[model samples]
Target: MKSFAFVLSILAVMGLAFWAYGENYKTQRALSEVESLQGQIGQLRETRAVLRAEWAYLNRPDRLADLVGMNFASLGLVPLAAVQFGRVEQISYPRPDALPSELQLGPITGAVTVSAPANAPVPAEDMLIP
Candidate 1:
């Protein structure tokens, strides 16, 4: 009976050790897979950035203008400044109303400084600061 119990105890210990080893191997493999996926993700992100830069370069205004200028001679459309481009100030404001409109009011605000009432609670200096 003693010999049988000792053998069974040794088998149980061996089984526990094998189970722990398998678990460690699984963890290491998962870590390696995670690292590999991170590298792939980084490379793909870099590729996407490069593609975006190229797309911007292709759609640049100067390049499009050059292409249009090369092609417009065949179209025979006479482009003028008023048609092709206009300044914001020229478009936004008319000649007659160049100056801002005169604000009509009850003359509430006066340009010249006036003295406050002698009995005023706050002095003019204190009121100005506040």
Candidate 2:
């Protein structure tokens, strides 16, 4: 009976040892995967930095101007002048179509604050001339 109990205990210990060995390998694999991902992230970050530097180099105004000059006949590019600008009031905003007659505005219940008196004189700074 004692020998049987001892054999059972030994088997239990062996089973546990095998389970722990499998777990250790799984942990090692997970660590390797994490390291590989970190290496890829570092490579991507380096590539992004190099690309940003290249973009800045290519977007230099002088280089762009030279390129534009070379393609001017085909591009028909023109310089901007102050006369090209327009006043905000000159913009023709598109109005949304009216809802079907069946739909109407809901009741307004929120508190509305009037910032300035209706009779107050207009401020020069608030006016837009152009």
What tens digits encode model 1's per-residue C-alpha lDDT throughout 18-108?
9999999999999999999999999999999999999999999778777778888797544455567766766754444464455322333
Model 2: per-residue lDDT, tens digit, 7-30? 999999999999999999999999
lDDT of 2: 0.82
Worst lDDT run of 10 residues, candidate 2, spans 105-114
TM-score, one value per model:
0.51, 0.63
Stretches off by above 4 angstroms in model 1 are 73-130
What's the TM for model 1? Answer: 0.51
- Total clashing residue pairs per candidate? 0, 0
Model 1, residue 6: distance off in Å is 3.1
Q: Which candidate ranks first by lDDT, i.e. highest?
A: 2
Off by over 4 Å in 2: 90-130
Q: Considering every candidate listed, which one attains the maximal TM-score?
A: 2
Tell how far residue 2 is off in model 2, in angstroms.
3.4
